[model samples]
Target: MRVTLPLLALGALLLSTGCSGAEEDAAPPPATPAQDGPAEHVFAPGEQITADLTMYDGDDGRRTPFFSGYRPTIEFRHGGLSGECGVRLPVELREFPPGETHTVVLECGTEVVVPADDRGFALVEDGVERGTGEVVLTGEG
Candidate 1:
């Protein structure tokens, strides 16, 4: 009995000591890279955007005094007469969440990519943020 007890105790001690290193191996979930901290794109459903970006001068849309009237108006023309989607921003102004992109030609050759959140889109071009706009939710889809 004494021999069996010592053998069992040794076995238990060995087992416990062997598992002690396991705690170190059992680490938490791997963390994301620091550069990949912020999410690039987020899905937003049941919403639409109404952006008022600055574009070149035109007869149809209103003009802006900012940047010496070089940017754009609310509804400006691409070059002249014909209004086309021109502004090219990184973010896309969404019409509906996870749906098709916004299909509104503000001015000719003036494109506005919207950085949309749950509420609306941010009016930021590249890394420089010029402004932001709100969107109306249309559905829960």
Candidate 2:
């Protein structure tokens, strides 16, 4: 009788835990960013821009530089303007400067068109926005 009583209590406890209402009402975990992808950035037209290429990590446990053979190419686009630029990775192997900073130049029509106060420059890779840079129209285009 004692053993049967204890088993009944244990079963009740298990049933209660398995049917927890709190668990059903709990929120799900947030989504995580992609690990193997190029980061985005923005830049102004005709402005010299530099970006960290090592921030992107591939599934092979190596940075983007290793995959690109040290010559990583980034795509820049704003509105209807778009172009690809090749960047050289830093020769040094230090964490302080993990990757080389390549100057990105965005060109518009014949005259460089700076983004208005409401617009932004978009750095793209594989059709993804990795970074954005703001430009003040100083009439220097």
The C-alpha TM-scores of every prediction are 0.23, 0.28
- Mark the regions of model 1 whose C-alpha exceeds 4 Å error after superposition: 13-35, 47-141
lDDT of 2 at 9: 86
- lDDT tens readout by residue for model 1, 1-141: 989999888888978877542457567999965552222222232222333333223342223222211232222122222112233232453222221233232222423333233333333333333333333323322
Each prediction's Cα RMSD?
A: 13.8, 16.9
Clashes of each: 15, 9
lDDT of every predicted structure (CA atoms): 0.34, 0.41
lDDT of 2 by residue, 33-71 (tens): 755322333444434443333232343223333322222
- Most TM-score-accurate candidate: 2
